[model samples]
Target chain A: MKEATTSKIAWGWLALAAVFLVYPLVFQSAFFRDIGVLLLLAAISASAWNIVGGYAGQVSVGHGMFFGVGAYVPLMVFTHLGWPPLLGVPIAIVVVLVLSVIVGMPTFRLQGHYFSMATLAVAELIRLLVGTWDFAGAAIGLSGPAIPRGWWDLTFTSELPYYYIFLGVLATLLLVTWQVQRSRFGYYMRAVKAGERAAKSLGVPVRRTKLFALMLSAAFTSIAGSLYAIKTGFVDPESGFGILVSVQMLIIAALGGAGTLIGPLIGAIILIPLQTATNTWFGGGGSGLTYILYGGIIVLLARFEPGGLVELWNTYAPRRWRSGSHAP
Target chain B: MLLEAKNVAKHFGEFRAVADANLTVAEGDVIGLIGPNGAGKSTFFNCLAGDTEPTAGTILFDGQDVTNASTETHARLGIGRTFQVPATFEDMTILENVMVGAFMRHPGRADARAHAEKIIEMTGLREHAHLRARSLGTPGRKRLEIARVLATGPRLMLLDEALAGLTPGELQQAITLVRRIHETGVTLVIVEHIMEVIMTLTARVLVFNQGHVIASGKPQDVVKDPLVIEAYLGHGHGKRARKRGPAA
Candidate 1:
């Protein structure tokens, strides 16, 4: 039984990997390819957020701070130090690590809603600081310097390179998720999520587990931020550190089914396209309509299927596949 | 010594929950701690288990001072406890619930699962191994709680109201399980309102009233003590004192 389950999971990964590898080849339309890039980035961010939000049950609404830092560090380095955005990747991750710990020291100890609020405040603080700072281009934000397009500089004109880059990023994050799911750390996170007191009693080291999860989450989120900034070549304070970005990540993870390994990817696949389609077709002038439609979908999902689409599928999916996605 | 608490006191705001309570238990001893509803039995247990630090005093476990230790620290130091209310991870399967505890000692998943399986079998939860904990009945939940803690390989186990909601058949089985755990050479401190189980299971009984230990000794002798009778039957002089059972 165990061998069968392991083989099934291996096949699941192989099948998904095969699909992603050939997706760009099969889908020739540049528009669809761009959408694929957006979906992959969203999935990466949401999957990163899931480490803390889904597994540790620490719903953070301030992850945009990490995302913002990820974008700003590389952009600043490129503009000021004349280095590629790739150079800031490690620095952004390190900075976010320290920030997450500082924020998590007090907030991780707080209960659910309060923890979420604390994160929101942290993101807002970063946004306000960046908005006023002249060195980081102030409220206008930093624009990637016009440099020679190359893999080393992480700059490219076509969407295909970015599509593959982000696909690779998503793959790494998914691999991390898979390892965590099968390891002792994954079990501890689930225990903490299920019952903190019970987890503590069982020697799960609740605080430390939460902090570790937050660090891993922040690191991945910063990577996503950097990649997103490089692709766009521009990142304003509002675009980088906005609450909307954090909300979207939260919605993607939760709407997919929080604790499941593939939930975030599934959520991004559905929500990103739906969002783009809605904005293109129904959007008359501004974002109000798009937001209202998005809000309504979120409300409906929360009301009718709080476990999200993955859970809905799990109930009806094959028994062999059902055991592979252990939902919290 | 397995455990010792010196002048331990726990206060929630102005209200004192456990007041200057001192206790000592030798290795491999089954000790019973009994008190009325608000007599601070659970509070004292929490202090010992490191769920809540005492407002004042020191707790020594396995010869290490652990007064300010976190619950995880206590757990790592081989002090395991159960809540008065069943506290299983409702989303996890019965086997997974126990395996979480086993994971503390055994870092490998397969080893933890193997150890947990044995515990589940011993606790008579083998039949329900794959069932989610939320689907369990009262007795099953209670046993599952014990199975989880037992998997932690605790040298000293504190059970708070383990037999609270069991049927007569379930109660007998639970009593046997407790005995089995004790026979494994784990020191035990049990908090039980059921006097019969306490009397049979514990070698010594400590009576608590208003956050203080009023008496401690052999169970039969403690039950016959006039002060214990008053504490249980009330201080008012009554002709019905002799007729009242301690648990009743």
Candidate 2:
């Protein structure tokens, strides 16, 4: 019986992968491809946040620090060192690693709301500093390759390449998340989420587990940030290290179901288009109406279903369709 | 000796929770620690289990000095323990809850799962392996805590009120489980309020009063100690209770 259910899940994932691969080709429109790119980017970063926030229960609210670094380092290297922005990815990863350790070490000790506040303060500090630092284009910010220097510049007229690139990265991130869910580290992460003291009594190295998760999460968010810079062709302190960017990651993962795998994708599926296309569809006076819709849904979900839409699905999903083992 | 404590003391500012407490355990022994409420029984148990650091003294486990070690280090060094209140991971199923402890020995998921499954079966939680821990009653949650510790494959186990708040049938089952565990040769140090557990299971007993070890001997003898009788039965009642113990 268990084997049958496991295979059923396997089939479901394979079918989803097939859809992702063919999504752009089937749609064949630039606008549709743009939505595809946004969807993938949203999913990638949100899934990254799920590691520390959802599984490890670290609840960092300043992930934009890593994201900003990711966006800036690539462009900084391009203009000063005359290297391709994509090649600067390794430097971005290294810098993000250093920052993650610094941010996680003391803040992780504070825990809960304190950790969130610390992360937010650090992210805001970085943003203000970047606004003044002339080396990073100061407040005006930096721009990527104007004319197509080459394929490596990632500058293009169509969103097709970006759609594919972002899709590939998202797929890789999902595969890593899948492996984590089945590993011993995954068990330790969940244990820490429940209670650190009890988890420690069970022989789990709680601090080390939280640190590992934060570092991994920051790295992936950096990659997504790099992708964002590549696609948008510009990144300022506001665009790269914006508070909205961080909150968006948290919301996307949470409202879709924070802890469960693929929750971010579901979140991006509903939110990205909803947030972007609301003005046209609703014929409203811009983002004011969108915020109400977004905030309203979040309020309802937080008050009624803290577990998010995934819990709703688990509770209401058909018997065979439900994740059988977790049904209780 | 499999375990030894030399004047282990835990002090909270001016208040002493466990002061100058000492005990030793042989490789396959089962011992009991008993006292009236606020007699510091749980505090002494915490000091020995490494959850609370001793203000002074030494602890040796398996011939190695483990004084000042953290609870995680103790667990890694083959000392497993259950909390007074069941701290079962509410989000996980019974098997998953046990798997967290099993991961200490078996790093791989498959091996950990197999080991955890064996522990759950041994603790009689096989029927509830798929059920979330939040759904369980007090008895099952306590057993879950025991099963979780058992998965660590500890050389010594510290059980804090494992048999408390149970129905008669549940108590019998829990006692049986403890006996099955003892038969496997795991050294056990139990902190229990029920004299029946000490009378029937423990070979030796230690009595605590006002954060000090007032008496130590065979369960029957310890129960008859004048200081212990006074601690439990009070100053006036102790005189009349000297002829009888909680159990003969």
Candidate 3:
């Protein structure tokens, strides 16, 4: 039965990849391409956050710490030493993986609101430190060195390249999340999230599972950050490590369905379009309306449908069509 | 001994909850643990299940020291238990709740599911297999709790008030099921306020009073002891106790 499910999922991905490959070719436009890239990046980041916040029931508002570090470390290294973004990305990932442990060791002990607040405080501290610290270009931020227009540089002259890169990254992250959801570690995480006491009673190594989730979540979010920096070609303390960035990631996870595999993608689908439409209509005043819209959606969803859009679909839709159809 | 607790004690602040308790259970033994409220029966059970660490003494399971082990470790070591209040995975189905226990022994979900089906059938919860555990009635939930623990392949089962709030018919069925479970060679330690169920199910009994064991012997003998009757009926009712039949 697992073999059947795996084969079915593989076929589903094959179908999705076919659509992803053909869509850009048929409807090529710079604006659409840019939106696609942003949506993909948001999906990747939200999915990464879901591993810990959604699946493991650990809400973290310090994801920007990893994102900021992921963006800056590679760009900073490249700016000073002339290394390529390709090499810098992996280096950034490794750095964040190490940083996750340092941060997680203290914060994971705290549960619920305390954990969320602690993570937010740590993220805020990082933002403040980045703004004031001289080594990280001190608030002014750092830009990557100039590179010729080439595939190897990961720098392109157009949105098309970024769209494809992000699409690939988004696909990879989604696949990773799916794999994790099916693994023994994923079961441990779910057990912990259900009830720490019960999971411990069942012999689940709760702390170890949480640490693993946090580290994996940080690693993926860091990769998204590195990619964001590369695509944008510039980064600042506010833009990279802002509290709003963390909130946005969490909102995406919440709106999509948190623990579900496709939740972040669903969240990105709704949020990115809404943000783009608001920006087009309201212009500079649109930012406030965007928050109002997001807040309203969150409140309405949380109040009426705490499980988010994925849960709503599961409740109403036919289960046979879904990718993963485990018994309740 | 299949499970043993040696001089176990627990304290909350300055108050002693369970003091210097010793217990032993061999394979296929059905031991009834009885006491009034605040006698530390629940606390003692918690210590044995590793939900709360004993401040002093040791626990041995299948010959290894498991004193400070987590509840999960105890579970994996075939020490399955049911909570007094039926603590289940509420969001999951009744079958899924059982599957979680089954998963303790079977790593694969398919195998766990197969095992859970059998347990659910045994508990007579086949009709409610897909229903959420929270939706079940009290007796149904108790049965689900029992099934959940039984799915874990436990050699020793700890049941806390498993028959606390059951209809007489349900109680009879539960007793029969417990006997059947014992017939499968699983040792049972039952903490029950229902004297009739305890008398019918247990071969031996241990009485607790004020956080101490006051009596231990065959159920018929232990219940007839003066201290056991006084503990149950209160000191003032000692003269009136003669009007009632023997304690058993």
Candidate 4:
């Protein structure tokens, strides 16, 4: 009976994946394709953020530093050395590792709001540094060098190729998240989340576990940043390192369900369209209304349903048909 | 000695919580640590558990110095401790809570689960195995704490106020559980206020008063010591408090 339910959940996920896989193909519109790309991109970034923000319960507001690092590195390399944008992926991983250590080692030691404040400061510092650096184009920002449209350079003319590329990246990140959720690290993360003191007493190396989570989260977020840079073919410190960029990822995770595997993806699916619609209907002024609506929804969720939409789904959904086990 | 501490002291700024406290416990010994409120008993216990570093002293477990080891290191070194307020992982199921401890020895999830199941059974928490810890009452939470610590495979267990919030019936059951734990050959150092539970459960008693060891001996001898009596009551009210009992 348990196996039957498990398989049923598996099929449900596959069906969802199938829809996502062919979404752009069926819609056959540039606007729909753009939304699909942005949705998957946000899903990857939000899910990556969930590793530290949700599972470890460390609310990082400086993840934009990692994302900007990922975004800026490839664009900078392409402009200066005429290198392929894909090379930035590997370099971004190395940069994020060192950056995560620098940011996490000291900030992770602080508890609760202090940690968030520290991360916020670090993110702001990174943004200011990038905006002032001449090599990184200062505040003017840098765009990807016009290269021949090819897989090697990752500079495709059609939005379709970019869509598939991001889909692949999102799929890989989701797999990594799933593996993390099943590992011993997942258990330790939740343990630390619930009570750091008790987790340490039980022999969990609390600081190191948190650092590991941060490193993984930053690495994944950086990759998503690279993907975003390639998709847009432009990078600015504002778009890359802005606090809004970090907060948007956080909102998607929190709204969809921070800790659950599908939460961020679901969040992106609901939010990306809402954002696009508001920006289109209200033009430049509508962006404020969009953020206001998001802020209001977040407040409501925090007050009445702290676990976010996933909890609502779990509570209302049939017991037998619940998608996944809540156990660590 | 299974555990030995020499000149353990802990000071928080101008205040001294534990001053020059010394202790030694043999394998299979059950020692009750009893004292009045604000007597620094919990401070001394925290030092021994490596939850906090001693301001000055050395703690030797099985002849190895572990004075500044972290609490996680202390657990890995075969020391398990329960908290004063019963720190069960509130979100986890009771079985999952125990499994975290079991994971110390058996890193494999299946092995940890099997070991945790045995502990759940032993602690009589089998009925509540699937329940979240936050839903359990005080006694259940206490047992969950002990059961989790036991699953860590500790040679020495430090229990702080494990019997504080129990009903009389639950107190008796807890005593039986502690006795059962002692029977399993694990050394125990229990910090508790209930004089009756301490007297019946512990073979030796260590009494603390104002950051000092006032007395250390069998429960009856330690309880009757004049300084311990005075510490519990006032200097002139020893007779009144003594008549009420060693701890009331």
- Residues B54-77, candidate 1: write the lDDT tens digits: 999999997899999999999999
Model 3 per-residue lDDT tens digits across residues A1-328? 4467668768976886787677667768877878878888999999999999999988898899889988898788777777776678888888888888877788677666777787788889989999998778888998875665466667887888788888888888887887776655776687678777766666567788899999999999998899999888888998799987888899998998998877888899889988898998899976788678778987898788988888787667676654433343
Query: Which one is best on TM-score?
Result: 2
CAPRI grade, predicted model 2: medium
Better candidate number, 1 or 4, judged by DockQ: 1
Cα lDDT computed for each candidate against the true fold? 0.89, 0.89, 0.83, 0.88
Using Cα atoms, each model's DockQ against the true complex is 0.54, 0.71, 0.37, 0.44
Clashes of 1: 0
| lDDT string, candidate 4, B103-145, tens digits | 8888888888999999999999997787678888889899999
Model 1: pairs clashing at backbone N, Cα or C within 3 Å: none
Report the C-alpha lDDT of model 1 over A1-328, residue by residue, as the tens digit.
6578778878987998899888889997988888889999999999999999988888899999999999999999998998888899999999999999999898777666887889999899989999999999999999886776666786776789999989999998988898997688998998999999989999998888999999999999999999999889889898899988898898999889898888899999888998888777766675776567558768988788877887777667877667642432
What does DockQ come to for candidate 4?
0.44
User: Where does model 1 exceed 4 Å of error?
Assistant: A1-6, A145-149, A283-286, A316-321, A324-328, B237-248
Give the residue spans of candidate 3 off by over 4 A: A1-19, A316-328, B93-96, B108-137, B242-248
Better of 2 and 3 by DockQ: 2
RMSD of each: 2.7, 2.0, 3.2, 2.7
Q: Put down candidate 3 lDDT per residue, B133-171, tens digits, no spaces.
A: 767888988888789788888888899998988888988
Between prediction 2 and prediction 4, the one with superior DockQ is 2
